[model samples]
Structures are given as C-alpha cells and as structure tokens.
Target chain A: MTERPDQSPLTSPRSERVRKAAALTGRSARRKQGRFRVEGPQAVRSLLTHRADLALEVFLTVRARADHPELASLAAEAGAPLREVDEQILRAMVRDSGDGGGDQGGADASPGAAVGGALVSPQGAIALATFSAEDPAAALGAVRALPADGPVTVVVLHEVRDPGNVGTMIRTADAAGADLVLLTRTSADPYSPKAVRASVGSLFHLPVLTGAEIDALLPALAAADVTAAATSGYADSDLFDTALPARLAWILGNEAHGLDEATLAAAPLTVRIPLAGHAESLNVHTAATVCLFETLRRRRLEA
Target chain B: MTERPDQSPLTSPRSERVRKAAALTGRSARRKQGRFRVEGPQAVRSLLTHRADLALEVFLTVRARADHPELASLAAEAGAPLREVDEQILRAMVRDSGDGGGDQGGADASPGAAVGGALVSPQGAIALATFSAEDPAAALGAVRALPADGPVTVVVLHEVRDPGNVGTMIRTADAAGADLVLLTRTSADPYSPKAVRASVGSLFHLPVLTGAEIDALLPALAAADVTAAATSGYADSDLFDTALPARLAWILGNEAHGLDEATLAAAPLTVRIPLAGHAESLNVHTAATVCLFETLRRRRLEA
Candidate 1:
C-alpha cells in the first residue's frame, strides 16, 4: 500500500485553480467554475471510477489516509494530483466549501466536534472534480435517444425540496433501471451534499437533468409515447392495480403538497400507495422507492 | 370556539407535583408520572385520539392556541385542564423539557422567537397523561394472545437507534396492520419527540413494547410459532422469492450494522433487498418500509 504523503506542495496553476474553484460555495459559482466537491471515500471513489474521463483533483486528511490506504492508489490510477492536510484543516476546508450560510465560520471553528459520532467524519476527505454538465436539452434528447426495444421510465420530481429524498429517488430510479431523473425548478440541487450522501454515489452514474420546464417536458413525454403516472395521497387508483406502461414518467411531488393542478392535468394516469395504517402518508423517499421497485418488478415479470 | 383562560392560576399542588415528576426526563420519571411530553401538534393530536382515556392536563402557548384551535376543543372534550402562557415561556418549557437542560429564564425572555420553529414551545403547552407502562410479561402475553384466525406479524427492531426511523417503523408496522412493534434495549425510545413526530401519531395506535432482554424475548418469539425473518443487504435469499410466513417477526438492525450474528442466527429466514444499482445499501427506514409492505402484500395474496 503506497502511503499518502502529507502536504504536497500546492504549486501548479491548474492545481491552484482547481483548489480555488472547489472552494466556490455558491451554486452559480460552482456552475461557472465547472467544478464541484465530492466527499466521503465511497462517493469520491465512485466519482474517480465512473467519471474518470473528467479532470479530477483529490484531497485526503491524515485520518482518511490511515483509514483508506487504497484511496491514494486510486487517485494515482486516475492520474490525479493528491494532497493531505490535518483533520482540522480538512474540516475547515469542508466548512468553507459548504453551501453559503451564517454558520460557516462557527462550523469550521468547531471542526469535527459537530459530526463526531457519525461514520464519515466532517474532516475526512473530499474530491474536486469536473462533472459533465448534462444540458437539459441534451438530457431530454437522451431520453428520446433510448432504444425503441423497451419502454423508457423517466422520474419527474416536482418541488421535492429535501435533498436526501431527491437523491434517494434518483438512486432508486437508477437501481430500477430508469432512463432519466428530472428535477423541477423548486427541487433541491441533485448535487447538494445531503442528496449526494443519500444517493451513495449513484449520482455520478445516473443522467440527472434539472431546471426542466415542466410544460415542455410534459409535451415531449407525450410525443415520445410516454405516459405520465402521477403519485398522489388521494388518488382513487391503487398503485399496485395500475397498468404500468413500458415508457412512463413517474411524477412525485412535495411531501406537504401533492402534485399541483397543472402537473396533475398533464399526467395521464394517477396512482396511490394504499395506506391501511394511521399514517397519512409515507416519507417521500420511501414512497419513491416502493413505486420504483414496483415498476422494476413489473418490468421483470414482463421480460 | 371556547377560549381557554390563562391556566397558571389553575395550577394545583397535584398539577405541580405531576409537572415535577415529568420534569425528570428519564424512563423512570415518565413511568412514575405515567406521563411524557408529546412534542408538536401532530403528536398531541395522535395522543388525543388514541390515548384519550389517559388524558390529564394540556398546556399551550397563545400562538399554539391560535395555530390549532381544535386543541382547545379536544382538551375540553377530554376534560383535561388547559393552560396558556407567553410564547417565549412555552418555547423555553419545551426546550428545557428535553434532556432537562437550558435556562428557563431565557425561555420567557424571547417568547415569540423561542416557540417559532421548535416542535413544542413551553408557552405552547405540556400535557400530563397516563401511558400503559410496558410489561415485558404483558407483551409476551399479547404475543400469546394473538387470535388463531389470521397470521400475526410482529416487528422487532434490534439496536436501531435513529429515533425518527424507529418512529417511522412503528407507524409503518401499524399501517401494515402488524400485531406489534418491539424494540431491543439499544433501540431509540419509541416515545421520543422525533420518533413520535415521524410516526405521525401511529405510536399511540401501535402496541409498543420496548427495553426487552433479548434472551427472554427470543424464546417467546419462538414459542409463538412466528418465523423470524431477518433483513440483510447481502443475504442469499431474494426478498421477493422468500416464502413469508403468516406469523412472522421481521427483525431490523441498526443503521450502520445490519443484524448481529446472534440475531441472524436466531432468524429462521433471511431476506435481502436486491440492489441492482451501485449504492452500497438502502436507507434503513426505506428498507424497513419495503420489507414490511412486501410482507403485507404476500400475506394478502395468500389470503
């Protein structure tokens, strides 16, 4: 096992630029720089493997190096520059690089104490990599681009703001072999740390298209002969009873508010997860998993 | 709508004693007082409906009163004394109520801001009520008490400490119409605010038996002729292919570690949720939901 050396001199202009670019916290800044920070060993490893075509910059804390020796080798395999810092500094870096907020300084000052009990340490390691920005038009084209041999399944999330739920849905959609995961305007950024963490690196593998105009997407879905299946708490049609189409776009909405009237109008079919218990509804993520897996099961049965 | 008058004046020596008893914030204290704080409107409503027989006292902030006018009527219908305090004081009360730490003076200092976002504000209201104390003996009896007609499903959570997940499981178990929800010694308190909130009041509807000695409960489970179905991420048997018994105890483990070897050994059946995607594992809550609902579907089909 090649041990990661601490403090590689931060010399190259590109390396400096990538590091500075990774530090950009604002969503707009990240988009402008064409770079984003991926954290945790599993996520970083996944990004390195599946997204090897993209330019990657890796950073590891001393603790992370001790815990994951293979990470250094993996970075080398990808021909990426690697650097190590103290756990405190790494934590400060994560805090600085976090979504802009009032608690940035306080979080950095406190360091690992905040997330001390969790498995992935706040101060562990992170990777700065260029994510191929999938153009919405291109992503839509890619949906159209799928082979005509089977039905295509696209996931459309409307105002589902919780990143964890969104991320889990995308991961579940991928697991179920869905074609695309689309996010509406009000949805949390698919790349947000929480969403990425929940997705368990599936984000890198899946085609995630965001900021989609629902009006345009709906018509395109229709033109592609894809039916929109809207999930609702009050829908009369039971989810298990619905005749699932091969090419379907499953539409899920906010936890508090179901699909808006316009979205519902666009959806040709609506289904409900039958609830017998006292709970009014399932957690959005859990519901999504249930629906996606059901679709997967149906497809398998057909095959 | 009948307005409940300021209740500080109605405080009796008995009320003070009950308040002091609940102030301890321990299992013993909750058991001794036969009362525990149910934070937030949803929990309060749940308790009000299902556990109304144990109604004792209700407290609320003026703001809480405004937000939930039905609370006043519910309290009145239950014949529980209702009290109102400054919003700041209510916020402090709830904040202090948890873990029994925090300055009460600070609670009353910023009344409106204090209660604004918290699950429960001190000014919002506290209720003194009775809960049926868990008697492992009684739970065992209930296991024995299952009717001979239909299959009985019991949910056993082993060391699953996330309060929210535990709560959600309890709710899901109830939703699936499971017979009981059991917790190992290490699992979260089913009555904790977060768990209660996540359950959305299913906690009261479900028969929750916690803090069991696994050594004692294992044999009882065996005696009930309930097949133990342990969930694993990498078990040999696919969950969809498994023959789910009519009488089954589904064992779920902690978020990080799945079922322990001993627990797995105790299980006659082990099932895995197939992950076709790259993600390492499903969220514990999502996994539990999938398993529980699968069992429900299987049982229904068999019926």
Candidate 2:
C-alpha cells in the first residue's frame, strides 16, 4: 500500500481547486474544462477501483480521512494528491455543486447530513477527476469494432432529464454488460452530482456519451449493423416476444414524455415490457433496468 | 356523470383541511386520524378508479381543476367532495410533507415533480383518503385465503428506511402483480408523501401493511403455506436456480445494513439475485424489482 503524504488542511472555502471541482456539477463547466467531480465515498471509491488514473485530486476532511482510511488509501494508490480540508470548505464545494440542495454554512451540518454538501455524502469522500471528451462518433466507432461473436448491448437515453434516473441507468447498463450508454442532447448530464450519486459508482465503469443527436447517432449505429430497439409502453411487440439481435441498442425516452416522434421514428422496433398489473407506466430507471436484464436473461437462456 | 359544483378557492394556507392533509405526512397523525393523503393527479385518479369509496376529500388548486377537468370528474365519480383550493394551500400542504428536500416555494411546480414535495410530481392534484389500520394477522389471513392454483407473490420490506425506495417498491409490486406489500415496523412510513409519490398510484392498488413484526409475520406466512424467501447477496441458492413456490413472500432488508440476523435466520430460504458485474450491490428498489420480475419470468415459463 502506498503511504499518503502529509498535507496541511486547506481552510479557505474559495480555493481555486475547490471551485473547479464544484464547477463540475454544471454540464457546461465539465465540457469546457474536460474535468468532473465525483462526490461521496462510494463514487470516489469507484473511481479508484475502476479508473484511478483519471483521478487528479482527492479532498477529504481531516475527520473523514481518519474515519475512512479506505479513502486516503485509494487516493494514495491512485497516485492522486490528497489534501485534508476543513469540513466547511467541503460543504462549500458541495453547495457550489448545485443539485437543488441549498447550502447551509451553519455549524449544525448534522452528522446525519454528513459530507459537507455532499449531495448524498454519508461516506464523506469527494474527488476531482479528468475525462476525455466523449465523442459520439468515436463511441460509435468502438461499438462497431466489436468482434461480433456475442451479444452487444448499448443503451440510448433521449431527453431523460432526471439525474438520479440517468445515473441508475448507467449502473444498470454496466451491470448488464453494456458496451456504451449514449445520451441525446436533451438528456440530463450523466456527470451531474445527483446522477453520479444515483449511479452508485457505475459512472466510471463504461463509456457514457452525452449530447449525441438522436437522428445522427441512430443512423450511425444502424450503419454499424446494430439494431435499435426503443422501450415503450404502447409499442406493438412485447419485450419477451421481440427478437433481440446479437448487436442491439436499447433507446429510452424522457421520464414524462416517451420518446419524441423523431426519436421514435429512428428506432427500427419498439419493445414494451409487459405489465400484467396497472401502472400507467414504469419509472424510466425501472423500465431501463427491466429491459437490460431481460436481454441478459434471454442471452443466458439461449446459451 | 356527476357535475362538480362551483365553489370559492380555499385561499388560506392555514385552512383546517389543508393543515390536516399536511398532518397526514406524520405517522402518528395518520395512525390517530385513520386517514392519509395521496397527492398528484395520477395517484388521485388511481384512488378514484380502484378504491373510490375510501376517498374522504379531494383538494385541487383552481388552476389544477380548470386545467384537469378530469380531476374534478374523477373525484365526483368516486363520490368524494371536491374542493378547489388556492395554489398556496397546495404548496403549504406539499411543504409540510417532509422528505428532506427543503421547500423552495416558488411556483415552478412542474408537473413532473408531482406532489409539490415529491421531487417528481408532474401533476398538481392531491386527495385525502381513508385507510384502515392494517392488521398483520388479517392480512396474512387474506393471503392464506387466496386460491392456490395460480402464482401469488407477496413483497416483505424489512426496515427499508427510505420513503422513496419504499414507494417505488409499492409501485413495482403493483406492476409485478404482487398480492401484498408488507413493511416491518422498522421500515419507513409507506403513507408518507414521499413514499406515496414514489409508489405512483400503486399505494391504492394493493394492501401495504406497515408496522409488521417480521419475526412474527414470517412464521405466520409460513403457517399460511406461503413460502418465505429472503433476498440476500450471499444466499446459497441463486434466484434463477431456486424453487419458487406458487405462493411466495419475498423479504427485502434495510437499504444499508441489509436483513437482520433474526429475519434472515427465520426465512425458509435465502435467494440472491445473481450479479455478473463489478457493482458491489443493487439499489434496494432495483433489487426488489429484479426479484419480482424474475419471479414473473419464471412463472411465465412454467405456464
């Protein structure tokens, strides 16, 4: 295990690095700087476990580092510089990282609401990480380059604005062994703190392309011999009855509105997860998970 | 078709019914008053469609009723008195309902964040409904009375504290066609505005018993001949390989610590949803959905 270097606590709430990290909550800032912040212990741990080299800076409160040795150890192993900060600074960082949660500078940052302003920071670790701008064209090229011997699944989310749902979809896509998670321009930013928290650390597991134009991406995937299937409640084919191809992409739409006409028109087919009972519709996350796992189940059955 | 009567908007945020509706957010109030609120248009519609007789009061904002003539129509169909209130009253009702997303009372209550506080209410319709205290003994008795010829699945939530997760479970239970959704005393209040919003409309679709003592509930379920299976990541039997009973109760544990030793030990068998990916575990809601759908898949295969 690599030893963490000693560092003085950075007491300033307006430090440059902290500001930069906080800026990551906004998609514009992330795209502009090619950097994003992963908050809380789970997401930071995921960064260390899956893609540690991308981690540039790790910040923890003195108490957090003392209580969560794994945070310091992982940061050390990832070779990222770790700094102990006053808890107020961390809250400022979380507050600056907007996710609808207002900032409370008061000392009563209850232990229950731990991690400064960590959107969901029960574990109290946050990281500043770098990223290569995800090129939809490049992602399309990679998906097309697969060896073609087994099932290849990709998930496309169009106009899905909920960060938590987007994050959960990424995690489900990862668990279902997806090749990529593509988002249309209208979708929520995959790197948003609320989404990163909801993804349970699966954000770093695979390629997640944000801001792809649906019309262009669908055609590109189709050209690459991937069949596009949109999950819909009113679709003609039941998911179980649909003949999912070896190379496929599952397209999901906005939480409130299903896929728009243009996006729906782009899909080759639509598969509806059968609901025996009455729920006018499934949550976007639930529908995505069921669709992904259903494919997984089918592949296993065929095997 | 019953016509909605013309009435003045209930403008005062401090009105008696508004405060009572707000009080329904607290468990003590719900238990003492024998009533609870179901917010948003979808839940209100479901209440009218399924158990209209239990509806005590229907409250809607002037704009909500004007825009959604269906809200008034449904309440009238349910034979419940519909009162048009000021939007401020609705906001106050939503603000008083706590899920820790502090009240930002400005009027951007987009239809998507359904219950003004649900963070996902897309509609502004809210209703007050009556519920009988769920007797675990009677609920178990009812499950035992079901005809044994078809699959009857029940969901048992043990100490799952998050109201959102609890509500999602109820909705999934409805979609999965589960006969019952029972919660241990340690679980979050199922009727809390947050949970009710998450359940979508399923809170009214089926029986959701709160304050169930798992140690007693499981044996009683066992005695009723409904096999009790606890969901665990470490269980010996893979869910796919396990023998599911015709009448089954799926027990899920707390979001963080998981099932207590006593609950796990009492379960006739523990079945784990197999995860082939690197994510440490599924979200409690996700796990519950997967298990129920897997059961659905298995039954479909057998049929």
Best model number under TM-score: 2
lDDT of 1: 0.67
CA lDDT of each prediction against the hidden true structure: 0.67, 0.72
Interface RMSD of each: 6.7, 6.8
> Where does candidate 1 stray beyond 4 Å?
A1-33, A96-123, A132-139, B1-34, B61-69, B96-135
Interface RMSD of 2: 6.8
lDDT of 1 by residue, B1-303 (tens): 112323445334234443453353345555555566665676676677777766676767677889889888888888887777554434443332444222111221222212111223333555656665656676677667766557888888888865657777888888777878888777866654445556767888867887765666778878878777887866899887778888888888887787788988878888888766566677677787778888777776787
Give the per-residue lDDT of model 1 (tens digit) for A204-226: 77677887767777877888888
lDDT of 2 by residue, A18-130 (tens): 66656555666676767777877778889988999888778887788887789888888999988777777786676553343221111112222211112244345778777
Tens digit of per-residue lDDT, candidate 2, span B51-160: 89878778887777887788788888888888766666776765544433222211112223332112443256788777767566765666666666677888999888
